[model samples]
Target: MRVLKQVLAVAAAGLVGSRAVAAVQDDPWLTLLLGTATAVAALLAYQWVVRRTERRDVTELARAGAGTRIVRGTLVGFAMFAAVIVTIALLGGYHVHGLGSVTGVVGLFGFMAAAAVTEELLFRGLLFRLVEERLGTWLSLLVTGVLFGLIHLANPDASVWGATAITIEAGFMLAACYAATRTLWVPIGLHFGWNFAAGGIFSVVVSGNGESKGLLDATMSGPTLLSGGDFGPEASLYTVLAGLALTVVFLGLAHRRGRIVPRRRPVDAPAADVTVS
Candidate 1:
């Protein structure tokens, strides 16, 4: 019941916020305003629901050092995507034409911000955290990661391979990020940075959402494996490799920090007797 309540509350805010942004997408100012509001509302919803349902504080979203964590995650995310784009460029798959709209970039920042926060809250903050209590870290990661990929299948240019790529690249990697830090801020920042770089900076189709008028007039060509074709660079082999590398690194950190929760065994024992890791 606790998990269900939290999920529904956060999901409701995310859905309503996304629809509002889409409805005002044509107007950059409105998009930015509503997107920011939506992001805030999502956070509030998560905090409210957690307190109401579980009667516990949301320490995962504590404000202490949030700015630093988010900034660091954003920088890492941008650098990772930039590296992938550079690799594609070297392979003759990517090219930049000229500068694009500043307004478009502003709108994309807001849009991506809302998406990142809400998604991290729903997926990692609630689903993975709650499930991990029962299934352990690895099993929860697998379940939530697959669900994340499956949801993206609703995108316009989605495919089996594309969904699979997202499962590995974003779903698993982002969850691992949360596992390592034990906070939603890092994953949220990473998610925003990656999507913004893809759509706002590179002017590429983001996760098959469609053409984005961003800061650069960019074009992609070459094999789908290298270029990611219509589904965007997120589906590129380089993205998967990069995501896998991060996942390994974060999981290693998690293991070292004793953050890896083990599967709960059926026994007649006190809850306090069970040790994590």
Candidate 2:
């Protein structure tokens, strides 16, 4: 029933999105912004309500150090951006230029911010943790990883191999990040960095659609394995490998501390009662 509710909610959101897109066909930017905002807001609102009902303070979500977490997250995200720029420059001779370039940067940031909060909330906060409550951390990580990759099937440039690779690689990596750190912030930064660097800097389709402005109008001069063909960097072998390596490193370091109450717990019990039980 919980799974059913989640599926229905996603489907409803998709339906609303299609309608919104059709209604705002004349203004692409406005449409994208508004639709994205609406979806994000709705998701946040729903989650907020759930947290409230559970008597869980939403602010007490992540166990990662707040000030340090933000700094580290932002740094990791910026590093990802730098890595992409370096990759593009090495492969396709990309470069940043002009005040005009800032527009693309800002737009990319907007998209990243949206993606960070929404995707983290969906995957880490709800899905991953839900599975964790039932299956334990390792199994939940695997499930969330596959689920994350599967969710991208509707993307314009998504391909079978790419999607499969993402499921096995990026999905697992992200789940591992969340599980290890017990914080959504790190994964959110990584996600934002990966997308922005790949699309906003390299002038490639992030998942499928081309970015507003990027360093180079790259023509993938190599095979699909080298250039990710249609599914973009998220599906690229390099990204998969990189994400996997990072996940390992993060897992090694994370203390695995957080407030994830297990399923079938006595909700009404006091702290002392909980310990006694």
Candidate 3:
């Protein structure tokens, strides 16, 4: 009941918020406002539901050092994506034509912010956390990671390989990020940073979404393996490698910090009394 309630409440907020943002995409300012509101609504919904259901504070969103953590995570996320782009460029898979629209950047920031917050809350905050209690850290990561990837299949340009790449790069790494830090801020920042860099800075298609006119008039070429084809650089081998590296780092930290949870063994059912018939 707790899980269902929390999921439903937050999911509703996210759904409505995303729709509102989409409705106002033509107006950058309105999109930004609605996107910001959506993010806030999702957070508020999470807080309210958690309080009612678990009778505890949403400690994962504690305000202490939140800004610093978010900034740090954002920087790291941006740097990682930048590195991937640079690598692709060096390999002649990417090119820069000219500057893109500044307005696009603003709109993208808003859209990506809402997406990052809602998704992190839904996947890492609610699903992974609740499932972790029963299945433990490793199993929860696997389950949530796969679900995250599968959900993206609904995107316009989604494919099997694209979904697999997303599962490995984003799903596993983001969950591991939460497990390591025990907070949603880091993963949220990281998610936003990566996405913003992809669409807002590079003007590329994000997560198989349609074309984005961001800060740069950039184009991609070369092999699909290198350029990520229509699914974008997230499907590239570099992204998978980078994500795996981060996953290993975060999971190692979690293990060292004793945050990894072992699977709970189900209690044996009481043996029924067998009277000789």
Candidate 4:
């Protein structure tokens, strides 16, 4: 029955995803917000139905607080994003946008929020947790990262290399952040910052979804390999290397914190057959 419930949840999430893609065909930013709202609503409805029918709570699967956990997670995630941007800037081949106008700044924040919520709920919340439960930690991380990249395959300017880079780089890094923090806020904030800087400030295509201009426009001329082709910095091998390094660092921290431990379920003796001897 638990397995059936998990399957149902995944199916429902897929339905929401289909709607999100269709909506994105409109204005990318607006669609992002709309899709996110729709997904949350749909999931709420599904949860309500499941609870009513099965008399079970879903919280046990992916439990975390709504207050402090989110705040701390987001702050830590912000630092990670800052580090990435700094690393990119130091590496050259990229320029950041300067907010010259109020409108542009507002628009940038809007895009950031919408994209953060949408991607976090889908990727970090549903997909990651679902895979983790069935495949164990490491395998789930790998599979989810690939899924994240594959989802962008149909984006306007996405390519095979771009998708592969995203799968191993941005995808893995974000997954590690979530796993390390065990909170959705960290991944959401990381996603927002990366996109905000890469596409909004840098004026790059965000995974081929949309183009954004932040305070300053970042121009990347050089070779496509250095510039990440049409997909953005996330598609570059350099970004992949950086992301892998970060992953290793986080994995080390996780190990030190004893995050990697054998999962166990306490065996409870079959409830004494009340009616039987």
Q: How many residue pairs clash in each candidate?
A: 0, 0, 0, 5
Candidate 2 local lDDT, 37-118, one digit each (tens): 7446645554555555555665425444755764576677557546644664467534444323444554555555555556
Question: What tens-digit string does per-residue lDDT give for candidate 3 at 111-159?
Answer: 9999999999999999999999999999999999999999999999998
Candidate 1 residue spans exceeding 4 A from truth: 268-277
What clash count does candidate 4 reach? 5
Q: In candidate 2, residue 271 scores what lDDT?
A: 58
Alpha-carbon shift of residue 23 in model 4 (angstroms): 7.9
Per-candidate local distance difference test: 0.92, 0.61, 0.94, 0.63
lDDT of 1 by residue, 1-277 (tens): 7788889999999999999999999898889899999999999999999999889889999999999999988998898899999999999999999998899999998899999999999999999999999999999999999999999999999888889999998999999999999988899999999999998999988888988999999899988899898898888999899999999999999999999999998687556756678
Which ten residues in a row are the worst by lDDT in model 1? 266-275
Query: Quick one: ranking by TM-score, best first?
Result: 3, 1, 2, 4
* TM-score to native of every candidate shown: 0.96, 0.73, 0.96, 0.70
RMSD of each: 3.3, 6.2, 4.2, 6.8
- Stretches of candidate 3 off by over 4 Å are 269-277
| Clashing residue pairs for model 2 | none
Query: Residues 1-277, candidate 4, lDDT per residue (tens digit)?
Result: 6545644664565466555645553455554555456545544644554566557775522445644554554565445545655655677856655544334545555545555655666666666766676666677678888988898898988889888888877678777777776666666666766766565455666776656555566655445566676777666666777778878876677677765434333466465467955
Alpha-carbon runs more than 4 Å astray in model 4: 1-92, 96-101, 261-277
